[model samples]
Target: MKVQVNSIRAGNVIEYNGKLWVASKVQHISPGKGGAFVAIEAKALREGNKLQERFRSGETIERVHIDERECTYLFKDENGFTFMDKETFEQLVVGADVLDEDQSRWLQDGMEVTVSLYEGTPVGAELPKTVVLAVTEADAVVKGQTASSSYKPAIVEGGIRVMVPPHIGVGTRLVINTEEGTYMERAKD
Candidate 1:
């Protein structure tokens, strides 16, 4: 479907010049002396090559048709990661590269995630907004360190190291922001 450039957003798939691209970032700017313009950072959906393009704010652009469905992670094997279509009961296996850093860390079995599909081919995986993980190792809280405000590095059960408040200890369950990989707060047991 063709839509105005101003309507595009990051993660949107678009078609231009007979090629499919995913918008990595987009900015709409209105200079004080000129007409509004839209700048986009996009990556090729098939080749993974990146490019930057600009257009008049009202320019029409083609939006690629993709199917995004919620799926529950079933498991992973030598073949790749597998997820079950929540609505169809069909299983799909996506390669490792399709899952970026943040998604890879939280691919727990049975976790619900959004999988983007192009022509029924899995293109990307989206993780939850936040995830709770158990800290496997953390530095002990030093006595009389009440004034300390610095975060310390700690390893979670999955070996993902993130900074947590100094007061946190091993075996503590904590909620983390997946996008920033930062500690949110202690998880209620």
Candidate 2:
């Protein structure tokens, strides 16, 4: 399918320069001196090479079709990540290289995720936007640091460090944005 440059969005797979690329970020630029165009940061679907391209308004690009399947994350082993199809219960093992850094850390057991397959092989994955994570270690609020809207570095359930509000303390269960690794809110649990 052909889609207008302005219509491109993150996660959209587009064909450019005779190569298949997945749009990771898209920005619409409207400068005072020039016509509008879309700036895209795309990664090659097969080779994982990243590139930036700009397309002028009214230009159309080919959109590649991908097959997505709903799967439940099982566990992470030395071999790779394992998942079971939600519908068929069939298991699939995917390599770590296929997932970006954020996805690798945020993936939790039994969490539902979308696996994108190309030519019957797993090529990509879509993780849930928000996840509940327990704060493992949060620095004690320094007396003077509280004067400003300061944040403290803390480690979460996955052993990844993130900047959190000063009030957040150890053992706090907070809602986290997996993509940005930012704190959203305190978890109800």
Candidate 3:
């Protein structure tokens, strides 16, 4: 699919210079003297290479279409992460290079994830926008820190740290934005 360069966002797969790349970062700049352009930092899908490119607002870019399937997390072992297709009951083992550290940290047993397939091969895994995790450790509120709204650092189940409100404490289940690793609110349930 062809899309305006400025419309591209992070995590979008695009084809540039006859190579498949995933946009890791996209920034739109409009200088006072120069025209508007979209700056993109993309990583190669097949090979682990990074590339930066700029495109004018009027320019179009090719967006690669990927097949997404809902798969249930099975386990992770010497063979890498294993996921089972819910509908077909097929098992897929994806490598660590494709899953990455950040994505793998949040993989909980029995969790469902969206696997992106490019030409029938697994390329990436997408986690839920928001995940509920319990706060494993929370810093104690300081004496004067409670005067205004402030955030404190805390650790979650995945060993990832997140800044949560001061009122939150250990054992509290908090709603978090997985992409940004920020606390949203206390889990209702």
Candidate 4:
């Protein structure tokens, strides 16, 4: 289906130049001297080559139609990441090539995710916007570094590093933004 350039998002597959490409990143830029445009970083699905393209906000692009299945993350093994269909209860093994390391790290056992399948093959997965994780490691607060803008580097449940507030410490449960891999706020529970 053809959609406006602004509608494109990361993890969307599109047909460009007669080739299938998966968007890795999308950014909207409105410069002072030029019209607003959407910048896309995409990777070729078959050739594995990456290309960056910019499209005017008014332009439309072809977005590939894919089947979105609600699946629950089971585990990761030598084969790859495994997920079970929530409805059918059938399992599907998605290769590492489909989901990057960072995206895979956010997966928790039994977490519901939307797996995008093209022609019955897994192409990508979408994770929740936020997740709750416990801080496993954190740097010691520096003297006189208690400024409101100061942030400390910390490690979360999946060994992912994130910049957290100075008050956050080991064992602190934090709400993390999965998409950007950043600390959002302290978890209520």
Superposed model 2: Cα runs more than 4 Å off: 144-147
lDDT of 1 by residue, 28-87 (tens): 998999899999998788888888999997899999878998999999887778999999
Most TM-score-accurate candidate: 4
Per-residue lDDT tens digits of candidate 2, residues 87-127?
88999887887776767899988999998887787877888
Residue 148, model 4: lDDT of: 61
lDDT of 4 by residue, 100-127 (tens): 8879989999899999998998888999
Top candidate by lDDT: 4
TM-score per candidate, in order?
0.82, 0.90, 0.90, 0.95
List ranges where model 4 is wrong by over 4 Å.
Answer: none
- Give me the displacement of residue 53 in model 2, in angstroms: 1.0
* lDDT at residue 49 of model 1 (Cα atoms): 84
Clashing pairs in 2: none
Q: Is candidate 1 or candidate 4 better by lDDT?
A: 4
- Model 2 poorest 10 in a row by lDDT: 94-103
Best-first order by lDDT? 4, 3, 2, 1
lDDT of each: 0.86, 0.87, 0.88, 0.92
